[model samples]
Target: MGEFEFLAKLRERLPPDGPQVKLGSGDDAAVTAPAGATATSVDAIVEGVHFRRGEAELRTVGRKALATALSDLAAMGAEAGEAYVVLGAPADLGEEDFLALLDGMLELAAETGTTIAGGDVTRAPALTLAVTVVGHAAAADAFVTRAGAQPGDLLVLTGEIGAAAAGRLLLEHPALAAELPESTARELRRRQLDPMPRLRTGLALAGSGATAMIDLSDGLAADAGHLARAGGVALQIQADSLPLAAGVAEVAAAAGRDPIELAVAGGEDYELLAALPPDRLVPASDASGEAGEAKLTPIGEVVVGEGVEIRLPRGGQLKAAGFDHFAGPERGSQPEARERRGG
Candidate 1:
């Protein structure tokens, strides 16, 4: 389909007005009404770097393109209002593939009650998708920041980590899948290929005195270190307390790697890490929307230092590491197209 056809399809899929949006797509600009505090975030995904052609389909990439931004909104304890995307591709790309991309993104938007407002399309050398999301907070101060953690606060995590990293590894080296159980391989691959944001859990904690919060886009150790530094306090994490998903250790062993390394340093888990005051450490069964049940668990504590430290067996300590764009490629870094293609 052409640009006009694309717009028409979008209009049919997304109405011009929504429950919280006054105006939407097919206009010079879209308009929307806000509910209290508003939060806006932007995220971009590119072919080869964030995704591999043989490993992930266009639909999966498109879903993740928006999910990344939604994860940011979830980190801030905000409810999504609307989203706009700017998609670009080479002239040679087929219409079917492009439509699949839109279908994938729209499915995520619908699941989260977020409306697609408007966006621009153009030609480019490679596939590129950027999503700008607008969200609203429950209250001005209800939104949590990385800087709000206080000493003595408990560090809580939603769900397990390292599954995505393992997934990426399998994608990069598909041969390894032969050694892993089919169920294990599928789970690992799914986490890397399609991930979800922690929206409900975040919203549930907004007014429950959650002090600091961050989404685990990178690895837990690295992102947790960031949160600790932002709060100007040391986050002493208990290594044994980390919530690693089942089969991670086996996957890591089969891949000839350490489970702890991936669990702490593997990126793109999209889990939420929060710092809560002592009294706010309610049972997971009691959290709003069943948000805490079975998924929320305490893994560490904030102390009076300036960085992060992990408590290990026999009083041992380990430094946490995460992905850093400026630090260049490390473990879990995606290969450049030329490198992957053996150029």
Candidate 2:
């Protein structure tokens, strides 16, 4: 199909526009009316660098491309509004594959109550998806940022970690799944392929007096560093206090890697991490469970220092590798692209 023909197909399949959107899709620019404030973020995933098309369904890839981008808005405690997608399709992509990809994003957009407002399509050497998302809030101050953390604030994380990293390991070395239960193995892979953004949890925390917040996209250790640096305070995370996904230890052990390291440095959990006042813990936890079905775990504290320190239970510091997009290749880093290879 031609580009315009494909776009027409997309318009037919897209969900109805959200409340904020005045004009959506098939226009030179999308029209949105906002009452207060807006938060925007963009993310892109490539065929080999971010995912292997051979291993993942086109629908899953579409979901992930949109999910990860929305995660940034979630960190800011913004309500999902609308999405603009830029899709680069290689010549070989069939019509069914293209629609499959769009269907995935449509599914997630409907679930999040977000509208697919507008986007552009083009030819490329690889399958590429870039998503721009805008979220809504009552006011600018109503949304949380990483710089708002204060000393003596408690550090809390929504949902567990290390599952995506373990999932990556299983994908790279399928033999590791032998020791884990079938369901556990399936869940680990799902965590890597279809991570859910903690949107409701973020909204609850923001309303519950959260001072600072971020999504765990680049692993806890690296993302915590970002939070600490932005807030100009030190973070002391207890190694033993981290909530690991059910099969992380098994997958890590079978792969001859440290479970804690995987949990700390394994990227793409897509969970929210926030700094909260001590008094807000109960309300935050209660609200988070009620809104998102996620439990808030107090993992650490902000202190009068700089950088992040992961304190081991036995009185030592644990070193973990963190994902960096522009850095040189390193083991356990760049979970999204660690196993990247051309099709």
Candidate 3:
């Protein structure tokens, strides 16, 4: 049977009602009535698709897998509580490696104040890690969404973009990664392996005049497009102003790739992008300050137009297009095309 079918059959065998399962199975993740407002998110990480087998450490892989699901919770302005894990591993993997993976996940969960309440394990041809996290918000309405953006809103991004993609490129080409200083390389690698969800920022911005918001899982251009399409407004990203971590330019130069393209189209940054009213821009900084790093940067503005576009400082506009997971393997694997700056 297919994955969904297998899961459905397993879920059907559960008892009709239980204290721990206020709402269970079939949804994104099971829910239990916590003390506060509730939210849930799930993420699945595959071996070949999400990570290379030998290239990544077991603990790091587990932490990253859990972090991916937690990002969804951050987007919903939720504070993490409990996590349930389901893992599928190949028969050939050693017991030590399996335990290391769990240890890694547990370490991160503890650090983030999330508990590992329960889990399931099974054997498969390839390794897959799936985590479902439950969290509580202070209020039910304290969640941001892509539907709230309006014309004339300012667009903002948190943290630097393209570091993860750059790190991936370095991992695939060690010679290029070695060209940079050890610290820079380490930071980029860390960004790729351990993405920090903007949980505090999302919580602060929710109901505080955020017009619309989304996490940058899929490149900025792609995620911005999602927000634009959902809100029925055009977004114009300022290419020149995108923040990049140190050594990004050097790495981009060595790889013969446009740093702007990487910044715009590279995925997995996990930073939050928000649309805010002009007056609310002040509070954006306030929200970011609570995070201590001041990760927010105003990158663009929402305006009247047909589709999303990127404005380069030089003299033109670049079309808004990035990775689309559902568009099939061919579309996702290809490098994004670079178009002239303006329509």
Candidate 4:
């Protein structure tokens, strides 16, 4: 049976009066008590697909797995509350390692003020983690979607991009990685292993007249396309204006890769990409007290077109193309793989 079918069977086995189950499992659907402006999101992590087995610590893996889902909540301008986690682990995982994974998840939950209210565990051939987070927004309309950008809007991004991608390349090529400074390598490693959601930035933009916005989980090129399509407008990204994290150029040069390509096509930064009205592009410091540390940089403009186009600093406009899941046999390319990694 498929995973969904299996989950349905498990839900059927639950007793009717199972603890505070205002919403039980099974049937065509189930209902939960109406929450205040409820916001929900789900994410899944697989062993070979998301991370290499034995390459990451149990705690770090667990923390990253949960943080992935929370990133979505933050993008929606939601305040995280509780989460449900489901695990599928191979028989080879030791009992202590399994416990450590749970402990790691709990650590992140405590830090984020979220609770692990419920979940399930099962045996599988590979290790997998899936999470569903439920949060609430004070007002439903306060949430941001990708469909409101307009012509003349200024594109702004929070934090720097490409660090996680650089870190991944380092993990695969230790010799080249050695060329990077110790501090740069450490920071890149942290970004890859544990990403912070742009919760405050997203919310701040939502309140600051952002026309459209999306979380930069996928590569900037790919996610920009999503926003453009949703908004029925064209997004023009300036290649020269991209904000690159410190040491990104050194790391990319060592790997013989293009730093701009890494910034455009690498995924999982978990920063916010927003389009704000031109006149309203006030510095982030003017909006929030902590903005000085995470400066917002304007890198593009929304235009009257149907899709995304990147204007290179040196030459012509290039179509914005990154990763797609159903691109068939043409899916193994570097950009495509990076895009698929986001989902």
Q: Which candidate is the best by lDDT?
A: 2
Residue pairs clashing, model 4: none
The digit string of per-residue lDDT tens for model 3 on 1-343 reads 3445444544443334333456655666566766657787888888876677776789888888888888778777677777788989787777667767777777777667776655676778889888988878767766676887888999888778878877767777778876789999888877877777777777776646787888877778888888999898898888887898777777788888788777677678888888889998877788777756446789889998657788888889865356554565445433632211100
10 residues in a row with least lDDT, candidate 1: 334-343
Model 3 RMSD in angstroms? 6.4
TM-scores for all predictions: 0.92, 0.96, 0.85, 0.85
Sort every candidate by lDDT, greatest first. 2, 1, 4, 3
lDDT of 4 by residue, 182-273 (tens): 88887886787778776666666767777788888777888898999999999988888888887778888987878877767777788788
**Deviating ranges (above 4 Å) for candidate 1:** 283-285, 292-294, 329-343
After superposition on all CA atoms, what RMSD does each candidate show versus the true structure?
Answer: 3.4, 2.2, 6.4, 5.4
> How much is 276 displaced in model 3, in angstroms?
1.2
Clashing pairs in 3: 148-211, 316-341, 317-341, 317-342, 318-341
- Relative to the true structure, candidate 1 reaches a TM of 0.92
lDDT of 1 by residue, 1-343 (tens): 6878777876776644557777678789988877788888998877765776657778887788889999999989998878999988777778778887888898888888888888988888888889999888756776778899999999988888878878877777777777777898899888877888888888877667788999987678778888988988998888889888766787688778777776777778888899998888884326744764237778889999887887886787765466654454454333321122110
Local distance difference test, each candidate? 0.78, 0.89, 0.74, 0.74
lDDT for model 2 comes to 0.89
Judge candidate 3 at residue 99 and give its lDDT: 64
Runs in model 3 lying further than 4 Å from the true structure: 1-31, 326-343
TM-score of 2: 0.96
